[model samples]
Target: MSEITNFKGEAVTAKPENAADLEVEALIRSVGDRVRKARDLKGMPRRVVSELSGVSPRYLAQLEAGEGNISIGLLLRVAIALDLRIEWLVGGEDPWSSDVLRVADLFRSAPAGTREKVLELLSPEPPEAMRARRICLIGLRGAGKSTLGAMAGAKMGVPFVELNREIEDHSGMPVNEVMALYGQEGYRRLESQAVERVIAMHDTMILAVAGGIVADPDTYNLLLSRFHTIWVKASPDEHMSRVRAQGDTRPMAGNPEAMEQLKVILRSREALYERAHAQLDTSGRAPEESLERLLALIEDKGFLT
Candidate 1:
């Protein structure tokens, strides 16, 4: 108190030294909230995630509420317990990560009229859109549907799946044996089941359907509703030639009038086949040529841009 001198200078104020520590605490709380939200979005209950990730439920809850300091190992375990990716816990801005935004960006940057054309290419028929777009190729046994479908699928970047082969796989028998054992009705039932399975499993594919599929109204309607049906058509003579070229003598087997029968079959199915969205004349044309025409029609109809 002697002289009451300002010994070192004016008194300095004590600043809030724990501000950064408080902010870190707040960040941990936010992280916990985000983790809970992600868990809810995945429709997973805490118990199931805990069992799957081998994390203790009590510890997980504590981590979620940010009531306890979680170690890095515990954080990872908690993230795994919640079936969450660690990157999601640590947030960042990525507007392009959304599917809708990405698609929008693609369309916006496209050349004039290109996006519309592409939409048309990918547009499904009203019925096809509602169910599954199962593009089934129906024709006489030798119309090159399988061959042309393979080529078309390669171009379209979709899997080329044969319905008959799938039936064989399911029945564990050769197609002819299955048909013989099941009769027409039995074969049809198997075919319908196979078609349903394929439609349920896949969203986009090229289906080489059995020729008899069109004969069954229910199956035919199902196909019409689900696929951009394209009939690969050819004259009876052409069909015979193509089949013979593939070394399949079954069409000509046991019937001297096989060609005539083929003509009749084609005549009966012409109207039915005409119901397709598009048709490609396979008569005299190479598979490549027919595929080009099909592609052109698909593009024109806005199937692919």
Candidate 2:
């Protein structure tokens, strides 16, 4: 019998029965390496990837350790969450050596302004023209995006939409129920679909999206290219107070370090939020006052024009 090295580099008799097993084992290790490399290259923590992909941290750990054989369905979810093509994860070729992937990598690492320039160069329409008169408000949950967006829409004589509500309507269930049933990966897919539906239905409207929408690069980039975006911001204290004012104490119900966690989130997402075309600070201000400023901002920015 011919001796061959198995996946673990141990010498073994090369039998036809185990040859297939060796190939499968090699494929598993290759997938695990690619997944780990992709995650590291994106600078995403395992927990963050798990949260976005709806995979458990322990499972991700095992996969990266080259021990867990993930399902195709779950692997596809991870690919989408990473904004990567599924083929990139499973293909036999080295993705890093591909010119297409190299360009994509460069684009992802480019500055926001540079990315916009590249988009303008590549797109058939100018960014503003693609956006038309549509506006999107993005920020933390308690940042008054919804309240101010609706008020602005009403006063400006345009349609207003809450993306979560859109997701709920499409799924025939509430947002929380959708999350409970479908997990983060499913919810994100629905969210992306909702954005597409809104864009197709309305060329001119005001839309408010959830805070975590920015976490998905593909969806967020689609938003940036299709709408005039604003970041509605408030202090951590204001964010907490506003949520509590709405009688939702989930942020502090059991988490004593909630405020600290909130701050950390804000700090982490600041760069992403800053990608918005404009910003409105609503901290220490009444909703009406903030709405007034938001309307003024829209006018000043000529967003509707």
Candidate 3:
């Protein structure tokens, strides 16, 4: 086998196979260190990040110390937990830089053997820049999309519009009444019309769509194509509490079968809900808390860019 050489041109021992593996490992360590540094700079603790990322604190510590081999999935969870991108986490470049020429130069001169390492050192684009991007909130009833979406829109300086309310406005009737009179099919048609109107009227808005929008494929697809969609999810227990708090007992309506109905509905729509660009679990969290998490996710995903 031919001998490999380090950057200093010193012949590397064949025992290590090549310098590339060492370089890659060093790159991972550097990136991990950067992540730790960034988190520290923000005055965030490892325990806080571990809670946000669903990563064990011990594992995160090991990762930051460059002593652990983490999976891409876990890395992504960490990146998102840090409100960062995988690219930004791996790359050492500033995430908020807008200088394309400088970025291009950095890319051009990277050694072919170390190119991937170089890319891994760059930071991801910041999410706040994408604040003007459209966001659509979808989920089952009582998911708190309306409350959270409103708060998110306010924080981002955008309008919060509810699709169901818009539908009511266009039809001049209460949503329940419209549904009763028009039936599910007719109500879906109306929902689609309202969605289109919202899409056309706003360049950027946070839309709190009705819970069952996904049941209408055309309307759901239209929303997906036109905006960044997030599903505000909650447990059945949370859903019941929220709905009850909103003064709507129609779900239970003194019926013992209500719980089973809810379970069935959730089970039937679980896959559809999972199709969202992001999922925010609202169970046991206040609207403001959920909004913060939603904003974080948007930022991490480059939606705010």
Judging by lDDT against the true structure, name the best candidate: 2
Give per-model TM-scores.
0.57, 0.62, 0.56
Candidate lDDT (C-alpha), each? 0.70, 0.86, 0.75
lDDT for predicted candidate 1 compared with the true structure: 0.70
Among the numbered candidates, top TM-score falls to 2
Using TM-score as the measure, what is the rank order of every candidate, best first?
A: 2, 1, 3
TM for candidate 2 is 0.62
lDDT of 1 at 228: 76
**Residue-wise lDDT of candidate 3 within 238-263, one digit each (tens)?**
89889999998888887989988888
Residue 94 in model 2: lDDT: 82
Every model: Cα RMSD to truth:
18.2, 13.2, 20.5
lDDT tens digits by residue: candidate 1, 282-302: 888887888898778766765
Alpha-carbon runs more than 4 Å astray in model 1: 1-125, 131-133
On residues 110-205, what C-alpha lDDT tens digit does candidate 2 reach at each position? 876687788888888867899999999999999999889888888889999999998876567899999999999999988987787788678999
**Clashing pairs for predicted structure model 1, backbone only:** 120-302, 120-303, 121-302, 121-303, 121-304, 122-303, 134-226
